[model samples]
Target: MSYVQQVMEQAIKRSPNEPEFHQALKEVLESLEPVIAKHPEYEKAGILERLVEPERVIMFRVPWVDDKGNVQVNRGFRVQFNSAIGPYKGGLRLHPSVNLGIIKFLGFEQIFKNSLTGLPIGGGKGGSDFDPKGKSDNEIMKFCQSFMTELCKHIGADTDVPAGDIGVGGREIGYMFGQYKRVRNLFEGVLTGKGLTYGGSLVRTEATGYGLVYLMDEAIKDIGKSFKGATVVISGSGNVSIYAAEKAMQLGANVVALSDSNGYIYDKNGIDLKTVKQLKEIERRRIKDYLEFHPKAEYKEGFEGIWTIPCDIALPCATQNELNEESAKALVANKCFAVGEGANMPSTPEAVKVFHANKIIFAPGKAANAGGVATSALEMSQNSMRYSWTFEEVDAKLKDIMVNIYRNASSAAKEYGCEGNLVVGANIAGFLKVANTMLAHGVI
Candidate 1:
């Protein structure tokens, strides 16, 4: 077996039952075959071995009280995976699915994702098994405070900086930032996704979604195609999906679909961004509620069936592994030309295979969905400078960054003999930077 294959097998042996981590490692390791063959020194130095393990894994108990005055407890984590280039940066995802395995998977993927942006930030991820879905504001606030009390020890303005992901959003960031300030007795850019009144950067909320679309726009445009008058299917109804829809519409693409955990909504007349934002962001209602406003639209029962909808492009903005091989084949059969991921690892390995095999213009989440963290790093820069840029300025910078990322990934793929294989290209491009940095600093 090859070194890549051996390392993957060893990783599985070391971390059994960590399917997500295994999946991430497999994808990255598989891509590194060409890279490793070129640089045998990386393997000789045990870079891959050290890179697989986090530098620090913090796990703690978070105790809080509900509005009913009942004592509650939740687990918290901060997987500072690697800081070869700069401080550890990722997001805190508050969901029931939060676990060490899932967080490590996210953190591992982040190591490369952050590198892909050509930013000075490293990789890390954290979250809790606490579900904020049905919690009241006060209860969530208490939970955030308790979670940060322990978290404050491991993070800072120049150290580990976290932003929002999934269940953790503007509200959650506010609660956590307030608690971090209270406990640390210091105010700093320790967190991104903050509200405008604080250290938050403009366009941070819409960065990932906008960036995802930006990457896709570059992809299709490379093939002499454009979003103008193209039919696009975007999954998810959260910040990523909502803003992606808005940007696609702005670019003249017809976004005809969006979804949530319960189901998906399809409107042949195109998705109403205003309605989606109001229903999901403001009201926190299910996507089915979208049908109440657009009575002419159709509501399906499951998210999987969404792939059957024909479109020129498909953006999987929902949770990880939400799209599978079956759905990918369905997309290919429907003659879908592109697939962009707005969420991390939203596509399974099998699904990715189908996209590549069919020659679909596939944009990996790390390269395509990196705008959020890139903007967070920008927010950190602004906080240090004690100033903020206008919306247009930050947005223009973001667009430039996305364009560069697309070019770098595309170029890296071609250079590495996998022309147009962004999965390999993104992984190699990201890994090469961090690995070289690691090599220069010497192994830790």
Candidate 2:
């Protein structure tokens, strides 16, 4: 068997049952075939083997008390996947679905995502299986404290910096930061995604979504197309979706849909950003509540049905594997020309294949959803300098970073003779940086 295939087989053998991690591994390694051929030294150095195996995996039990004085135990994980280039960086996700396999997949993806950002940050991801939904503020705070109490040991401003993901957000970040400070007795930028009042940088909240749109705009503009008057359907009503919808609209696109895990809402007349923010950001209610405000909008019971909506552009800002092969075909059949991922591995490999076969402009998550981590790095810089950039300044820098990502990915794809296949382009470009860095550092 080939070196890449051998490495993949061993990875699966060692990490059995981690389907998500296996899938992420296959996607990136398969794309590196051309690069591997060009650099036989990578195999000699066992870079593929070392790259797949995380440098460190921290797993601990988090014990917290509920509002009723009942003790609850949850599992926490931190996969410090790679730090060849710089410090480990990623987010901490808190959700019922979070597990070792999921965190490994996210961390593996982050290795490339962070590299693509052209920032001096390595890759890592940590989170817990503790569901913050329906938990009171006190209960959530206790969990964050418990989770951070142990996490603080493996992380620092110059070591590993974690932001927020999924169920972990500003509120949770605040709780965890407070705990980290108390435990470490140091006030540093060990975490990103902080609120502005403390040390958060401006435009950090909107960075991911805005960055997704900016990259998509660059991709589409290359084909002489623009967001103006385009019908855009974005899944998820969270930060990425909301801000993507906002920016798409700012560029003159008519965003018609947004969804949550429970279901989706389609506003044929265009989504009202205000109402979505109120319903989701403020009220923290189900997406079905969106219909009460916009009574004319249609609410569906299933999330997959959102893909059937006709549109010129589709942004899957939801969870991993939310969009499948069937959804990709449906979008293609409906004349959807472009798809940008705003979530980690949101599109299944089959879905990505369908998009490529249908000639859809597809942007993989590592490159497309990288805005969040890239901005998190920016926040770290701000925290280190003890200064903050204005919203416009931060936003401008984010746009430039995203644009360069697209250009570099596009150039890499063309150079490798895979022109327009951004999945391969992004993987190759991201791998070269880390692989070269690994080689220069010798076998760790």
Q: Highest TM-score, which number?
A: 2
For candidate 1, the per-residue lDDT at 219 reads 85
At residue 390, candidate 1 shows an lDDT of 99
The digit string of per-residue lDDT tens for model 1 on 1-444 reads: 998888889878988888999999999998999899999999998899889989999999999999888999999999999999999999999999889999999999999999988889999999999999989999999999999999999999888999999899999999999999998999899999999899899999999999999998998888888999989999899999989989999999999999999899999989888988888889899999987899999999899989889999999999999999999999999999999999999999999999999899999999999999999999999999989999999999999999989999999999989999999989999999999999999878
Encode model 2's per-residue lDDT on 173-198: one tens digit a residue.
99999999999999999999999988
Candidates' RMSD to native: 0.8, 0.6
**Candidate 1 at residue 32, lDDT?**
94
Look at candidate 2 and give me any clashing residue pairs: none
The whole-model C-alpha lDDT of candidate 2 against the native structure comes to 0.95
How much is 386 displaced in model 2, in angstroms? 0.8
- The global C-alpha lDDT for each of the candidates, from Candidate 1 onward, is 0.93, 0.95
Candidate 1: residue 89 Cα off by (Å) = 0.1
Per-candidate clash tally: 0, 0
